[model samples]
Target: MQSCSPFDQAQRGDVEAKFQIFLTLLAVLAGTALLARRVNIAPAILLLIAGITLAFIPGMPAIELPPDLILLLVLPPLIYSASVAMSWREFCANLRPIGLLAIGCVIFTACAVAVATHYLIGLSWPVGFLLGAIVAPPDVVAPLAIARRLGLPRRIVVVLEGEGLANDATALILYRFAVAAIMTGAFSLTKASGTFVAILAGEIAFGIAVGWLSLRARHWVRDPQIEITLSLLTPYIAYWIPEHHGGSGVIATVACGLYISWNGPLLISAATRLQGIFFWDLVIYLIEGMLFLLIGFELRAILERSQGIAFEDIAVATLLVAAIVVVARFAWVYPATYLPRLLSRRIRTRETAPSWQAVFVVGFTGVRGAVSLATALALPFALPDGSPFPDRDLILFVAFGVILITLVGLGLTLPALVTTLGVARDGRSELVFEHENEIAARREALAAALTSLDALTDHRELSNQVVALLRARHDIRSQQLPASLDDDAYAATANARALVRELIAAERKFIHAQLRAGKINDEARRRIERDLDLEEASLTNRESGTAPL
Candidate 1:
């Protein structure tokens, strides 16, 4: 074979270097996540620190985060996963508050940043607004992770999750408007407002259509692997179609995920769901870990490029912007929480007014994340006439700084803050109630299933032995469920589960021995092992108190 050219050799070398960097990042991501779990800190925070550390290490390559990688590759799945997990009923029930935060608060924060930066920092209004739009939305991944773990009230969790899912669309739409205004040197409120409405309606409709089609196709195909593949593709199809046509694909993805969430149970198979959940969980975890690490790495690259700018000036601007972001949230949230109840007696009758502590927790949890950084990085280098984009570097630095402050600073403090304010006191009680409800529901369902079985036995010529076996299986399962997860009951369940796991281990050991002894073929051994594995997994779930009703 002929020797490769110098250009080809260089290209190959670059590819190899990038591949090595990717492998190294993966190692760092995994380690950081494990460390976070051990220390009980949010993984995102540690991952960010790890990235920053790695970035400064001698011989480490400069890692550039392309906006497309985040917006296109990373975002759709993150949004889709979150939306699917959200309860549509809860989302709709709390529509007013979610909208207040997702729509009103985003706009409020954006405007606040815009006005502050313009007056204090001397940036032009359009550019300032662009910066505002970049950092407006609270990140879904980091804050929600912390909130769920903290055991806040379910409604608070729902509101936060719902807000995170939808706010990006609002911020992004505003971002586009700001960019257009900057580029054209003119802006129209009326025109932009109407366009925004149209885009929202259109994207929602399209997203629903995508969800409908995805479910139907998956149902038709009826293969676990194929169905999972289709599910993976669903978000992208929902996202890219409207996005290419000038819509904020965020809403479309959210709508699609919600539609599927409500409808998927009946259509999707158990095998697909069971396997897909694990697959998606792993995918999201890796993506999230790597994203945070990359975000940290971005700091080094940004600092290198900002050699001319004074560190003090950047620090002051970052501090000012971060302060404004935090304060604006508090200012808007209190009024938004109480003002509606004051104005509308209907609201007061329908819902209890939340405690100020809960409201404070919500306001404090406004941690900016990767989306802000991505938006900042995505800003064009030049305007329409080839003029340099004003304060682009400053925006990037501030956006990253704000993310650091909010995500790390606020995230680390939120747990203690929730405890100090007693927001989770009711949450603990609610969880107990939920566990009891779950047990009740399971009993009711099994009773219904047994009633159906009795009916089937009477109608069909079923053998007594078959009927007895079926009834006994259900009885055993029902009996295994504890009446309550009290300390005594939990201890008994744990001991029982441990014994059962030991039994499963013994069975697995025997099966492997048989295979080794040639008493069973490899296929037969695998089949038996799978059954044993599932039984053990069920026990594990119950032991962890995570088994579904």
Candidate 2:
């Protein structure tokens, strides 16, 4: 073999180093996630801390997170996943509130930041507005994860999730306008407003078109693997088209996901849904964990770059901006929640106003995350004239500070706030109500299926034995459903599920023994193992209250 050239050797060394770094990061992510679960803290918090620790360790390489890596690669799937998971009916029903928060609140908060920074920090208006837009939206992934576990009211969850889905579009649009104004030293409210409207309309139309085409294609393919591949591609298709043409891409992805969510159930096959759920779940989990870690790692680089700025000044700007973000949300949320009903009689008749406690919870959950930092980092180092961008380092430092404070401070205290306000009690009651409705729906569906089965039996020639077996199976399924969601009934159901799980374990043990003894081939064993695996998974889901009724 010939000796490798020096350049080739260097290339090989670089690749090896990168691969090692990848493995090390993966190890950190896994450990942090497990520790978070054990300590009953949000994983995002721990992941961020872990990343900070790793970043400062001697001899550890500095990892640069490209702005596009987050904007182009990570964001689409996260937004799409959330949009798909959201209930379309609930989303539409709460559209007014969602829009207020997603659109109006973002605008208000951005403007608040702009004014505060201009007067207090002495940044120019355009640069201040740009910073405002960067930090306007609360992170969807972090707060929703915590809120769902706390069992807040379903409507609150829906509104928060819905707001999170669309707020990025609002913030990003404003960000672009602010950037443009700064670069050209001019601004136009009228033209910008018209452009904003046109982008929204165009993206929505494009997103729906993408969703429709994707659904039809998946249905035609009829193969689970191919359908899953298409599902993975759907969001990118929806996002990239709009983004490439000066739109936010967020609205288009959200619209696409919602369209597919409402329409997909009837078109998608059971196998595809089943496999796709697991695939997407794992994908989102890894992506989210890694994103937070990378965010934490960015701190070291930011600190290194901030050598020229006074620590005291950076701290003051960060604290002031963070305070403004929190206070402005409360000021905006209360009015936004109640002002419409106050202004319109028709609104009063159509909607019941939420409690003050719930509104407070919404206001208190303004945790920021990766988007603000990414946007700030994406800011140009120099203006179009090759002059240094004013206050660029300060902007980056303050943005990071705001993210750290909100994510750690507000996120940690939210659960206690909800508890003190007795929101969890309302959430529990809502859960009970939902469980009752689910039971009723299940019974109605079974009855309908049985009625159809009877009609088919009357119209076609069928053996009595076959008809009897089918009837017995349906009866067994109906019997398995709990009569009510009472303590005694729930306990009985849990005990039964535990017994079924034990039986499944025993079956697996026997199957493995037979395989070891050469009683069955690998292929046969795998076939049987797959069936058993699915059955066990169903039981696990049912036990955890995640199974579909």
- Global lDDT of each model? 0.91, 0.91
Report the lDDT tens digits of candidate 2 across residue range 48-71: 888889999999999988999888
- Kindly list the per-residue Cα lDDT of model 1 for residues 143-262, writing each as its tens digit: 888887888888999999999999999999999999999989999999999999999999999999999999999999999999999999999998888888888899999999999999
Tell me the lDDT of model 1 at 494. Answer: 73
Error of 1 at 132 (Å): 0.6
Give each model's clash number.
Answer: 0, 0
The positional error of residue 336 in candidate 1, measured at the CA in angstroms, is 1.3
For the record, the alpha-carbon RMSD of candidate 1 to the native fold, in angstroms, is: 1.5
- Clash pairs, candidate 2, are none
Candidate 2 segments whose C-alpha is farther than 4 A from its true place: 546-549
